[model samples]
Target: MSDIAKEIENAKRIIAEQKKRIKDAQKEAAKAESKLRDRQNYILGGALVKLAETDERAVRTIETLLKLVDRPSDRKAFEVFSRLPALSLPPQPAPDTGHE
Candidate 1:
């Protein structure tokens, strides 16, 4: 083959390799972002659970929200919250005016 033919083949190979590399990088980035999102959800859920354990409003709100969980598995996962006794939430504390 001529030199020009060989150079064209080499350039095409490089382009193909670069495309694969870009695709792999994008997949890796997407996976990392998914993991981060899951971690954030896990942390937020834990905080909510902790708050619900002590606060009447939080418990009631969480129980109310659980009604929206239509999936059997999700409903089953929420069984732990079902055991909290219903309680009247205390009036919310007034916000500080910062005037002092």
Candidate 2:
């Protein structure tokens, strides 16, 4: 009877340890998911900003090209090509990548 009781206590200890591990794992997974979501949001916002910058730059370049062209046909074509969707918001300055 004593040996049986000892075995039951040992089993309970093992179960308790496993339960703790499972809880820890669940918490870790939630933390990881939160971090992943933050990273994804950061990347998405950056990409949208980059695309806006590119569009703005293209429009400016096209305008300059149109001015430089002497022929009417070339200027018209460039004007048509340069037209793009209006930006929803003003473009933000790109962060400098050169600094450490």
- TM-scores for candidates 1 onward, in order: 0.73, 0.51
Mind giving the per-residue lDDT tens digits that candidate 1 earns over 6-79? 99999999999999999999999999999999999989977877898888777767767765676655655554
Best by TM-score: 1
Count: clashes, candidate 1: 0
> Could you tell me which residue pairs clash in candidate 2?
none
Q: State how far residue 74 of model 1 sits from its true place (Å).
A: 2.0
Q: Residue 1 CA error for candidate 1 (Å)?
A: 1.8
Candidate 1: stretches off by over 4 Å: 80-100
